[model samples]
Target: MKTIEIKGSFRKELGKKNSKLIRKEGYVPCVIYDKENNLHFQVHENSFQKLVYTPEAHLVKLLIDDQEINAILQDMQFHPVTDKIIHADFMKTYDHMPIVISIPVAITGDSVGVKAGGKLIVKRRHLKVKGLAEHLPENLTVDISELKINHSIKVGDLAYDNIELLDPKVTTVVSIASSRVALKTEGEEVAEEETTEEETAEDKDKEKKS
Candidate 1:
């Protein structure tokens, strides 16, 4: 995994008022926790955009008071209305310790079913995986080049080294279904509406004649 360096300073005071003041200054209050200790610090809010927005998972290299540590983003707080990040939590990473992380799923290759007028449906955009910090992948790729109509790729179909998928093996990840399925359902709905309109029109015509 790639790492980005973030600089921070220790927060001497901890309170709601102090945290609000920190945000007002364009900084976000953050906490770093590990098996050893938990530390309170603050970092510039804008500096976290790359880490939060990217699809690839990353290990953060936090530099605090001349000390450096490798960590992963564990959680965050956001503004209720604007949805802007207000705070973040960093968890220390150790080489042998197992960690759970969600990795984006990337589909590769052309689907044979789509070429035959089928539609590709992706059910899961990401997969939860558990493994050692070093073994976790940045993203998982699924190949649909040979997918045929009515065929699906399930979680059990995936194979990776040193990592375990946390999702149920039977859960569907992607599938190629006939396009007619959607059109048939829509046609049924439209036919029902048309039948109702005809019935109403016939009733109105009889009432007028009476």
Candidate 2:
């Protein structure tokens, strides 16, 4: 995977008040969890633009107090209203150990189904995979050049050396949906919309609790 550098300073105090103060200063409180100890630090919000806004996975080079740490972003919290990032959590990584992360899926060729008047639908923009940090890729490529109408590319069809796909083998990553199939799935789309609303409510509750 690609690497990005971030500079931060060790946080002397850790609490809600201290964290609020840090945010007021345009910094985000962050933690790096390790097997031995957890490191607390604060980084400028601007420093996360490339790391947080991008779809591709990246190994982070965290510079804290003149020390370097290799880690991966584990979780992030954002403000409920403005959607500004409030806090971030990272997990320390080792060269020999395995890491699990979602890698962006890059669609490479034109689909044959589209040329046949079928609609191309992406079911997954990313896929969760587990592998050593050195073996993980920046992005996973999916070729749909030969996909025909009503056909799909499932997780089971993909293969990568030294990387294990974590999603279910039956899960479809992309499909060429014919108009007839699209009409048949209208009710399912409505059900999905309801589920999304429920998830949004749950996220708002989590933000309030935090």
TM-score of each: 0.80, 0.83
lDDT by residue for model 1 (127-207), tens: 998888778778899999999988999999999999999999999999989788655755787999999999999999999
TM-score between candidate 2 and the true structure: 0.83
Shift in Å, residue 209, candidate 2: 88
Instruction: List model 2 lDDT by residue over 2-108, tens digit each.
Output: 89999999999999999999999999999999999999999999999999999788999999988999999999999999899999999999999999998999998
Clashes of 1: 0
lDDT of 2: 0.94
**Cα lDDT listed for each candidate:** 0.90, 0.94
* Worst 10 contiguous positions by lDDT, candidate 2: 179-188
- Identify the runs in model 1 with alpha carbons over 4 angstroms from their true place: 181-210
Distance (Å) between predicted and true CA of 2, model 1?
1.0
**Could you say which candidate leads in TM-score?**
2
